[model samples]
Target: MTDGASRRLLTTRRSVLCGGLGTVAASAIGMPMGAPAVHAAGRVVKISMQRSSVLFTVLKVRGTLAERLAPLGFEPSWHLFTSVIEPMNAGAVDIHADVADAVPIFTQSAGAPLTFYARERGAPSAEAIIVPADSPIRTVADLRGRTVGVSRGSGSHYVLAAALKRSGLSFADIKPAYLQAPEGAAAFEKGSIDAWSIWDPFLAFAEAKRPVRTVADGTGLTSYHRYYLVNDRFVAEHPEVVSAVYEALSEAGRWVKANPEAAVALLAPVWGDLPPAVVAAANARRSYTVEPVERAQLGEQQDIADVFLEAKLIPRRIDATDVKIFRPSTVKG
Candidate 1:
């Protein structure tokens, strides 16, 4: 993609901008008719969200983010994606709702011009290595020689890798089936795969409907933070949009935690009409506390990058603290 083309892609449009990725584009939330035009002139700010990002999805569905951006003359254009890493890296989107810690590491290694603005604090229990309920894989060690399904470069992938190392095994000990969530779930159900490394709400969904057992979670393996990011170009051009997004995300997360029932009711339908109970269960495992990303907090990210590098999963080594960070106004230096 040319520099001009990439810039154009980052700038939003009334119509679907980038297609062919199975992305479901939601209608652009236009500025209110009487709203004051502040900085930009009703420019659309493209943001991508996955169902796993509970707070982001809630904010999108409830129009909280749209409301926040409207007064600033920025229309919020929401897009549904199973993973936002690629689109953000390609500069196809302006803001990434949230992606796993490992994702940014891989993106950084690829030299994607991305900046971390906010993060959902560590929720170590949200992701795990799940096995058949009756399977004899009693421990992480038992996973050796087993077929394990994982989303390549996901936080859960790092969990599986870390778990294996803790148990005196390496990533090569098992046959890895790199599958997305749907494929992994189906393969796990068919008994074609011995185990799956997955995260909520998929983790909650699997446990609710399938006979599965969690062998190990990220308790001591990984912090499993979810990061909110934006393309570097977007950050440079519209720092106000970035701040609006950060504040909205932080508020949305607080709302979800404070009003669990109402939040579950709102998110259940968005998550393909999942049961409220399941939604609540998934939400419980996640820490919806959004905070600014600081250099000191990047220790684990560097560790994740090193691990992926040692395993040859990422193309090159990355210094996790090398990227830019947008400090929200609420957070003082």
Candidate 2:
């Protein structure tokens, strides 16, 4: 059979299977219909977004994805999650945008059926390890034996590891407080942690709200390429929807790059009315261009996986290319 016919057959089989599953779940729950029944025709595509994700936030705020998908007979559902891997593993979302490269590596290592559909160019300076302006921690070396706040398994974790390795230090040299971004921000303000390693908007917000110095950033250390991922089943069942999302995001990325002021204006409300200057600063450090995921572009991911394995952050080593990659034009049907 041709690839297009094969995909259609697979989709049909999946739809029937999902319908049965929905009936079974509803019966078990003593309900007439279940969650999957709500999407009997699979018209709704759930998108999980992180607050700090610039391109996704821009797309969400402007309702561009909905506008793009409407004509394609798809509805876009937006949901917020603290991190990308959580909703994906829980089966709560179909597509998740702006996950850090390290996140997928860890998720893949955990044996989740996740696949990459798109990627952003590296924004090395988009994340940083910062200290209060009046603090005595003057250098990366000074971090040794000090408490450092970082969200464990996050992009910032990889950045901290790389930065420390470049400075001839290791994870064992400092006390790691595995706090979320908001918690880390609070800790940083209270002087409970010596420094906080974090990404943009949070980094930008901190800098704008107080005096902080960049002890080091991802530059010369890690690539900081964010990725968009979807459930493996979603790709097999809805390639066209995936393609539409990719095109919509790519277009939004371009729009943000060309219209910084408008981008800031649209995003400020979602960010709790962050100063336009802060948002602009965060946007400046990011590379908003989106492209297809390719094995050739994943060398940094291998390094990141190795770092996590060495640090015992992940259970095992992972081949970064082992997961599926959805190429946009390859959707024959």
Error of 2 at 199 (Å): 0.2
In the range 1-333, model 2's lDDT, one tens digit per residue, is: 567766654553343223211111111112111111122233787777665667776766576776777777777666655555555666667887578767887788777787788999889888999999998999999999999999877899999988888899999999999887766777887789999999987888888878999999988888889998988998898888889888888898899999999999887655655678988999999898898888888888899999888888888777886778889863344
Clashing pairs in 1: none
List the candidates' TM-scores in order. 0.87, 0.85
Candidate 1, position 97, lDDT: 59
Best by TM-score: 1
After superposition, the stretches of candidate 2 with alpha carbons farther than 4 Å from their true spots are 1-42, 330-333
